[model samples]
Target: MKKIYITFLFAAISLFSSCDDWLTVEPKDMVTVDKALTTPEGYTSALVGVYQILQNVYNPGGFVMGSGVDTFANIYTEPSIGFSQSLNSAYNYNFSDTSYDNSSGAAFLQMYKAITNLNVILSSIETTEVLTAEQKNFVEGEARALRGFLHFDIWRIYGTAPDDNAGTSNLILPYSLEVSNEFIPYLNYNDYFANILSDLEQAKDMLSFSDPIIYYSNELLNVEGSIEEYEDLGWYNRQNRFNYYATLGALARVQLWMGNKEQAYEYAKEVVDAQNEDGTRKFRLGTSTDMGNTDLALFVEQLFGVETLGYDDTSYSSYTAHCVNSEYVLNQVYPSSSDIRKMNLFTTLTSNALVYNAQISLKYSLMSENDASAYKNFPIIRVSEMYLILVETAPTIAEAQTYYDTFANSRFDENVTLTEGNLQENILNQYTREFWAEGQIFYTYKRLSLTSLPFSGQEMNTDKYKIAIPSGETNSDL
Candidate 1:
């Protein structure tokens, strides 16, 4: 049996980057609650810290899963002969390999630690007097949303699917509401979903009252009509944080996972219905022209995303290793000869001095020299996904067709028609292309329980759909 343990002190250490110098402190195993949560700014700083950790979740490569990992949605192929030790077992689906234990174990610990930090902020918001009612609500809402989001992710990777599995009584992950170091027993699948929904609903309610666009309008310089007076309030970054729509998007996703089609459609509709004062959609679909000479224009389509500060180094390496020079996988994803993405979203190097000439995806690849770091933000959700959810849960074929057409027309010159018979399958295929390296493709396969995929030599196996719990936590009080 694998020995499991949770280090409260080490987890307590903040892994936030000190680039902004907002909450910089010496490296320590523990951070006292009073020192980090006494002031309103401190709470906000902690939230930023959470975003930093999230940005690092898949660094040196944006894909959370390893390249050529059969256990995951094997969309990309690496030309390299071998993978790092942390990803070897993942590639072969060998759960018993102790060498792969650290990768999952470290992520598990970090996610829980971030949850604990969010709980601390949530706890402090009620008592902290420095913040006004609006500030308190905004802070509390973002914290709860982050907490719910993280827990939902943990449940997806570690918890067995209640929909796919016949035996739904097994306990999976430790879902906690408090910041204590005590060992919380795992909840059944039903109870786990309940806990996740509870957090998300509370977050939605809190954020409904705060209204991120208006509340943070001063900080959003990119948008029109800058409120100069409120600009000094800090927290200027928009793409990195969980705004109102992001929270709603999370709710819609959770509802879909629970098989609540009506509720999912309702929430997704709310996201799609969101419009600016001028009647434009809050999030709009991208155009072929938006692909541009560089991928920088793609940022305008993000409903929610995280700015990867290490993009130049991390995303560049990951894209080159897995996608560039791998013609088979590249052709598999963007298979259509006339696909605009194949032409606009990719570029090939041709200099004789270069080591090799290969096509790399400009979507995730960063070009810092051109000041495209703003486009380096990784998308978590988009309006395009809202359309996908709407189509997936639409009651009528006509309604689903409308939603599908709205998205397809935006991306392709030819009108892609959808019939009720092939709606689900086509939606899955669209997901394969739409998300590409966005990380939702794997979850789509798992959620729908469909067997075949775009990966080379993929077989139908339900067990491979879910990742095994890392050895470090196998015997712990989970």
Candidate 2:
């Protein structure tokens, strides 16, 4: 029994990296919270296990699962939907119903699995005599917040996910995890956000302990200790776990999405104020440094993200071990003075480089063997976003100016300030440039109901903003 349970535990952790046994962990096997969290290691393992799965939720090399691991959605590059419209299958763009339908399953599967783990934590924390009350609450908060965070992701993608999981009626994911044949309840937009906000609001208060180490390296680098020293206190740092914080960010984001500007401003402010000890803000700007400094520093922006914490050392390394070289932005990089990402951060290819190289994949640079691993962890909901939310939602132009001024000047070294007539556009455009390659680009475009003027060549539809509910999800139930 011990061996079987232990195997299940290890298998869960292994799932994140496509480990031999990890990929096969079945969802049907029931492991009680009491049994899973019997020890501190068990509890930690459960939490970390879910996070590891996040690394694999999407395939990073291409679109779909890891496509937009960092904030930038890499595969979607076009005028419609702004950057991610697909011209060919190779581009792997899924801006409409099909993408959302398929993605919802994958997203829901992982989130539900994590939620189950959290449910276990929530249920057992009370019975476990060894765990402290605060510890129990912290863990529970992490789980609930994470559950809310992922659900919000689903809602964002599908637009009408419901609270009830009847499976037959609503949009849900993971054909493998479904236990019921009945229709699932699809959440309306308002309720979707309400649940998200509720979870985050509680998570904000539930999380107590704080770990100051803000950067987390890929576990693969740990072979050389590159990913090993992720924390100053080193035993898994669940205290500053991203699942909870991500929930807070989702709350602010959903609030903004719902046009509750005041609440958006409120929650976003909360996240900004919760910076790392060194004052390097979470989900803020990248490390404005030269890229070639380490040949592997190209993507160092997200090295120590909350999700990367406690994950296996080789996860990121393996993800980035093999990458095709691209030079779409060589001009951007060579000019150096244009955007700092090209100038100081990215390197110009030499005589041996390919002439048809695409843009320098501005979000991340090469790690080992020119794979995407070098790009650091990009915060999905960084502290800077909160400020932007406030500025955009400011009650008046003067208030907007005040918030926008502080946020813009502080985010980049250039110190951008908005002028009178172009207040909203200025802030929105700045968000585009500042957070390019990061995933928030589309959302920014969405909130404003603005469409790209025209890309270099591609045609974009201003009306085709919200991805329609995928046909797979539009059964008789919804």
- The residue ranges of model 2 lying beyond 4 angstroms of the native Cα positions read 1-35, 62-108, 111-116, 123-130, 160-183, 208-240, 243-247, 274-287, 290-338, 345-357, 366-378, 395-420, 451-463, 468-478
| Per-residue error (Å), model 2, residue 98 | 8.0
Candidate 1, superposed: residue stretches over 4 Å from native: 1-5, 8-35, 58-71, 78-88, 214-225, 314-320, 323-329, 347-359, 367-373, 476-478
Candidate with the greatest TM-score versus the true structure? 1
Residue 398 displacement (Å), model 1:
0.7
lDDT of each: 0.65, 0.45
Candidate 2 lDDT tens digits, 1-478: 0000011222233233442222222243223434456665456556666666665453333232234322222222222233222322112234443443454444444545555455445555657875566566556677667767766665454342122232233333321112223333444444455566676677666763432222432233333334443332123433225544555666777777766788877776666565554565444433444343532222322322323222232332232222212454344213324455444443333321222332334333333233435333433455556667777777777777776766544434344455567777667666655554444555565456553421222322432343444443345433
RMSD of 1: 4.7
The residue-level lDDT of candidate 2 at 23 comes to 21
